[model samples]
Target: MIQPQQQSFNQKIEVSNNFGIEVYVKREDVLHNEISGNKFRKLKYNLLEAQKLGFVKLLTFGGAYSNHIAAVAAAGKEFGFETIGVIRGDELVDKYLENPTLKKASENGMQFEFVTRTQYRDKNNATFLNQLEEKFGDFYLIPEGGTNDLAVKGCKEILTDNDKMFDFICCAVGTGGTISGIINSSYEHQKVLGFPALKGDFLFQDIQKYAENGQWNLVTDYHFGGYAKINDELKQFMKQFFKKYLITLDPVYTSKLFFGVINLISKGYFKPNSKILIIHTGGLQGLQSNIAEI
Candidate 1:
């Protein structure tokens, strides 16, 4: 909530007339430096609730290059709360300094506890959470992808009345929270499309939990391989995209989402003169780790 008054605007992307589609990007990345894009939306109310409950510390889970981890750390530093990140992959315990994201989080005063992948999977296990509470004393828990009722509530504000002009509302889905909020806030005529970064059948059920209506659909063909997986095609696309639009897309999420939307347009998925609005949920900080590839 550093710049709570900031509002994101939609900038139109130049699409070919042959495709019969109009693409616009919601520049949520400019909302803040650390808590950029959907991270700020997801954490807004959670942070307020934590403070209301008299908690001075916040705990969350993520991987080595997680945007959520970095954002949580930055929020903790800026908002005056102690922060802890339970990082996946215990091997990173000794080499975290080599990672830009982890190093930045550490600099922001986030304490880290590296756990193996198996242990990290138990993040929601009652006994595991109890153990963390026992060790950390007391802290407000934010989930791995920062998805929850409050998070969906905050995300609901991503769209405004002006956004209703678009026929399709699109965004990159992480844990389904952002899309759920969009689904709820969307006009009944608008089709909420989510391009997921991960591959799984569970996401449908996960999204169904918070979504109030059935106006949304997931486009799963564009994950590249899976979460955090990238190839030369994606890297080249990112480079060419930046060269053309001057918009830097994160390898993990936004890049794939944009790619999918463009591909769909080329395939005649959208009708003539369809206005598609895509959300830019920033994860650009992750470029530091994958810079060599791009």
Candidate 2:
């Protein structure tokens, strides 16, 4: 359920003076809700799994600006579940945060529990969850970014209507769920490409394990500066991209992959006349605070 804006099928190639190759964007930023993007699909199967497991409470993790957290919180309120968001770090000055993602999560009636970065890493541990079950009672846990089988299943639904096959399908890889899901459902004629937003060191293995040997291509380059970091060049390109196409690309995830798509295309990567489909994982709500200006 990518927001209406993110799911929009408006498709075309926009040639920008800044980018050497012709780029066609899927217009996911406009898919649905202002907050739509990758978050909805990631949560879809997860919610179903929660229901199947007979779980009443859902606990997950994210940074203050995390799209997954916001999506889960909103989904919880809408679908009848107790949602707990383990926000990384203390709240500090909430007003200083430019991204309204966290605020929206609260409005969605999601409960929050802030933890140190160190503790957050071990949140999936038996001890942590045992304590949680003791206090909250029957609950299911979803990994950060909603990385799991349900996410892949939901993403598979993205392929039903589109008939075109692609030389390579690319997406901004955060936790490897979106790309892996696409690869799993991709027809033989298509190959999946992933741009790691963080270090790709163990990501290939992660995707393979998660997806169970689906057709995939790992194109590592466009992680401007790790997961949450942005740079001036990325901002310049984001602005230029929108100016040429009148489509918005927030500075966080999709923008990074959009940049990588161009970089790979120009460097003798994609075959000529090859159809390259990019999965815009949606996170516009998380982009309100990031730099996207030249």
Candidate 3:
């Protein structure tokens, strides 16, 4: 892990005087430009473990615009390890250079193997993994979203003693890793709320696999249609939020999360005087395409 010179801090968000709740955002985004937020937490120990195991190369999986792919590529470049991204969509094989995320990863010295979406769906299959092994030789395999036991272990370190004052901890969920880690580290007095970026019932079960306790709940109302899907209202909300807070929220995750939490506050979802802390798991690099639209 490349420790930042300055650590993440909690910054309070000013909401309407009508609501009696206090909301603060943990600026995990400031940790590192590329390895910011939960990606840093998720990959910290995974990279160390890979190096400890004497692996010279690392392989992971993600889509063309996945934050995990970008982070892994940057990490590999900085740490002197070869990175391989088994990208989804064989159609992108020739045109991946057009994609900001993939282009950035490639520039960081990461190699890519484009596969069909169907093949990506079955990426965990033993046969396919064996084929990758035959092709790329030995490498440390980090899962799609960089979620694993080590990743969870790294995530557990996100919370500090200063966070104990909050009554509720909130974060955007993707593949269940970040929330699970937060759930494990949460104090008994705090409730963990996850705003999933994608709509799916499988998340609960996946979260259950790693969460050490049951104090977490998924807020399914704010996915904004589904993963990577955006709308005019959400775009406006994000724009207004940045204008008001001077903080940029990525359209894919943090924007929806902040929108949900604030909307819920307006609806009286949180108890009066409750303290809320929202985890800002950064993926601002993925916002490159949405910036022009916003």
Assess the local accuracy of residue 31 in candidate 3 as a C-alpha lDDT between 0 and 100.
87
- Better model by lDDT, 2 or 3? 3
- Where is the poorest 10-residue window by lDDT in model 1? 285-294
Candidate 1 global lDDT: 0.90
lDDT (C-alpha, whole model) for all candidates = 0.90, 0.71, 0.90
Off by over 4 Å in 3: 291-294
User: Cα lDDT for residue 69, model 2?
Assistant: 81
RMSD of each: 2.2, 3.7, 2.1
**94-155 in candidate 2: lDDT tens per residue?**
55134477777777887777777887787779897787678767778888878888887776
Clashing residue pairs, backbone N/CA/C < 3 A, model 1:
none
Q: List the candidate 2 regions with Cα displacement exceeding 4 Å.
A: 1-10, 16-23, 91-99, 161-163, 291-294
The TM-score-based order of candidates, best leading, equals 3, 1, 2
Q: Which has the greatest TM-score? A: 3
